[model samples]
Target chain A: MTKTFDIVFALWPRCAQLDFLGAYEVFAHLPGANLRLASEHGGDLTGALGLPLRDVEKLSDIERCDLLFVGGTADMSAATTPGMLQQLRRLGEDARYVTSICTGSLILGQAGLLRGRRSATHWAFLDQLAQYGAIPDPARTVRDGKFWSGGGVTACVDFALELMADIEDPTYAQMIQLYIEYNPAPPFGSGHPSTAPAEVVEALRARFGEKLGKIGGVVPTTALT
Target chain B: MTKTFDIVFALWPRCAQLDFLGAYEVFAHLPGANLRLASEHGGDLTGALGLPLRDVEKLSDIERCDLLFVGGTADMSAATTPGMLQQLRRLGEDARYVTSICTGSLILGQAGLLRGRRSATHWAFLDQLAQYGAIPDPARTVRDGKFWSGGGVTACVDFALELMADIEDPTYAQMIQLYIEYNPAPPFGSGHPSTAPAEVVEALRARFGEKLGKIGGVVPTTALT
Candidate 1:
């Protein structure tokens, strides 16, 4: 019999829509993947932009899995709900591969999985990784032992394809890329602060300065709200 | 009072997850944009990979909308139920701007909106547009009058970004691009048939050969199931 890999995606209220779904798109096509979405509050959960995620399983019940994926939320502060952090920590310890996209690395940091590990997160929150004893890496995706992390929202697609190459084969990853037509052609070419105009970067820094300073908190719902 | 643009996304079972959500990630952030996911089922709908979409509105209730967005499904045969084609035809006529991502353009063709229009669809299905009296342009996105169409799944993100620049302003579109970190770095360059290896393209053509021949029909779920 072929080996079937159980994959769990940790869904939560206000999670960034692209971060989770982008990865799901790539991973779902893997040969033996048994994919499932889980959250602390099962059933329906709302993501950023009022997008609804339906019929999510309880994270606590998903005790064992091959891979566990956690995605970011619009509000970084609300990302680490106390129960959610606990569930993530438990699942992180259990899964063969622990993974995240964007600020999801922050949740891994909060759960102590990133301690002394080189990790990646959204560029806006890269420096904040140090607070949780994580060595911040600015690469698009970073892998340290069993833990894998990727930068920002759309990075999830690249991260998933890379992960597939590691877990399966390079051919499988390339095939899935072709399946989704992953060729991107951005007209403006200003996706990052480094690439964007100076004034646009400054305006964004000022706009996100408050959230950047307070990366994670016990207050919940305070950041990016 | 500020002007509000009522945007409706026409949804159905097994719609390509990335096709709709990628566009949603962009348009949801637009100022005064009232967004909704509407379908015949009107509640929880399953997308590809068994991913659940929550709280969709009924299509019959939405009499008018500024933009009506449609997305493709893996099996285009399963995409258009009789009632769904009716709803699409009604809404496509009412919407100021009618748009689609991937093979969703096929639905618009069925609705008679694509007659003599230069449009785009997934590269694999591009030639099939000739059957519906639509001129198929293999570009990622094409615009003829009020009808807008895009290539495959990930192309929806580029399609939405372009739409935002046209509908609102380039500044707003660029800002959203930054927020989502629209920069893409694919590990392998095999997104299109032209770029992918000859063997891979041949394999895909053989894999999808039958479905391509039959546009939409009662081809039992055996194709991609």
Candidate 2:
């Protein structure tokens, strides 16, 4: 019998839904993949822009998992409570693979999971990774050791595909891609700062910069020496 | 003040989550957009692969909407109930635009909304569109009058961008694309049958074909003459 891979997603209120949902779509198809959603408080939680996620398991209740994933939130403070960080540290240390998408990397970093490791996050917040002792990689997805991260909201799909390839095989990942019909055909070419129009990128950078500024920075309490 | 667009998603149990979630991610960002998730029975609904969607409104309670959207399901019978089709027909007629992703066109077609119109759906089910009087278009996204459809699951993002461009403008849609960082970089080229390895395509076709066969096809009770 195939070994069941217990995969848990640690989510919080107002988290970007697509950050994990995109990956969830891909990972749910993997053979023997057992998926669960957990939050700091558990129960029904509203995600970004009023998306509802129900019956979430409390972070404290999950003893361990094969893979632990987290998605970014607009308000990082909600996910950075000391209790939440401690729980994340516990889960991350025991998981075979630790992963995140979008600003989720920042949460992982705050938990001291990304110290001295290369990671990726939303392009707007890439520079902030250093605050948590993580080396920020500008790639859409980055993998170092057993820690994996993806950039921005939609990068979850790409990150999951790559991780799936690593966990299973390229053929299996490719099959999942085909099953979801993930052939993307974007109508515009402004997904990244480098490729987006200068004006568009600058405007978004300013807007997101302010949001991040309000959240400030939390010291990585578990930073490695 | 900008006019609020009442965008309603008509969903059912087992409907592909990404089919609506991808589009929802985009639509949620639209200026003056009011998004609502409604199911045949309302209340908490479990979607594809056990994704819980909470606080969903019942279709019978929604009077009308600016745009009515639907996503595909693994088992079409669940979405083809007479009561559900009647509600869809009512909502689609009043909405300014009628849209779908993946096999959702099948639902709209059965609601008597796609007769004699060009539409697109998942590659595997493209041929089935003719049964409901829809002229199947092989494009990734197709727009006929105010009826828009996208191919397969991942096409939801592309379709939404196109619809957004129409609802607002190209510049606004491009800005949203950048915000979501939707520049997709699929790790595999097997998202479609045409580009996938022949063996992989054959295998998936066989599998999906069996599932579709088991669900069988429902006669378009409301198909236009």
Candidate 3:
């Protein structure tokens, strides 16, 4: 019998709910994969929209895993925390695959795992990858060797299936996709910045520019909270 | 200024995470929308993928809301639970709009909310809507009169934006869509039964047929554990 594939997601404050939960569900449903949530503090972590994740393992306690999954958050402050960066770096160094979804690439980049690697992240923050010596690509998902990153929040679904396909097979990915009914139909047809009206994009920039700008470089850990 | 719109989601065991969470995040971010999760028992409800939802209000405590949302789970078990159905009926009756995601429509159907209405649900179980006198349409998202239903887990995003557009304006919905970067690109093209391979669909039917059959008719509330 094959050994179980261990997958761990680094949980943090204000993480996007879908970024980790979406991919976590896909892997949890897959046969022979051990799934867990890891965080600085082990219990009752909150993500966006007041979503609570229970029974998370302390990050320092987990020695290793087959895959280290990092997800992005609405606030980038956690990514720049010295302790968070160090933990991500340590986990990335040992994991068989270091993967991320949405702005999670920012965390990976800050950890030095994406140094000289091509990556993809939320389109609005793709250029910031350069600050950490990573090449940013605008694709929905990008893979460079063992480093995998996805675009924005919804891109986590794509990243999950693609990673599943790579590790298991397209057949396994297809089956899970069907079971979950992965069909997506955006009613407004404007999910991408390019597809959205210029005024709408400007409005979002005005709304979130300050928070997003903080992601371009790692801020002092003390600056957070 | 318009009165704050009230929205409530019926929470239950095994509820699909994306079903309500996807839509909830969008609405929670929208201004003037009061969002709350209401479950039969309330307090620290666990859903699919072991995702914990915080601060869910007790269903009996919520008298009315502008919109009543219900989400689906892997099995149809929760939909047939008498207590859940009664709460849904009570809430749906008072709400201006009754909405659901994935097989959540099954719960609405069981509560008699979908009686004589056109609805959409998870593709695999669409035909079962007939058991509750509902017209099942395969559209990604369907809005008939005051009832709105989405096709599957991922369809919640579309259902959310559409509902947002209806309550607010298209531009507001577009702005939120851009903020979340809702651009969806499924790595595998098979998100629907029509697009997935026959073998994959067959495998799913074989795996889930037993749990699914119980949903065709209302099971005794006592039957649920």
Each candidate structure's count of clashing pairs: 0, 0, 0
lDDT for each residue of candidate 2 in B46-125, tens digit (9 for 90 to 100) = 98788988899999999999999999887777788888899999999989999999889988988888999999998877
Sorted on lDDT, highest at the top, how do the candidates line up?
2, 1, 3
Q: Whose lDDT is higher: candidate 1's or candidate 3's?
A: 1
TM per candidate: 0.92, 0.94, 0.92
Over the stretch B1-225, how does candidate 1's per-residue lDDT look in tens digits?
168988999888877888998999989877789998998879888886687887889998888899999998766565677678788888888788999988888777876678999998877778867777889999998999999889989999899999998998887677778777888899999988889987766666655456444322232222221
Model 1 per-residue lDDT tens digits across residues A131-175: 789899999899999999999899999999999999988876887
The candidate scoring highest on TM-score is: 2
The residue ranges of model 2 lying beyond 4 angstroms of the native Cα positions read A205-225, B206-209, B212-225
What is the C-alpha lDDT profile of model 3 across A106-146, one tens digit per residue?
A: 77887778889999988777887887799999999999999
The segments of candidate 3 whose C-alpha lies over 4 angstroms from its true place after superposition are A211-225, B1-3, B207-225
| Residues B21-134 of candidate 3: C-alpha lDDT, one tens digit per residue | 788878876677888888888887778767756677888899899999998876556556777778888889989999998888877887888888999988877887887889
Task: Please identify model 1 stretches exceeding 4 Å from their true place.
Answer: A203-225, B206-225
- Measured with C-alpha atoms, the lDDT of residue A154 in candidate 3 is 77
What DockQ does every candidate get?
Answer: 0.67, 0.76, 0.68
How does each model score on lDDT? 0.81, 0.86, 0.80
Error of 2 at A216 (Å): 12
Model 2 RMSD in angstroms: 2.8
Q: Which candidate would rank higher by TM-score, 1 or 2?
A: 2
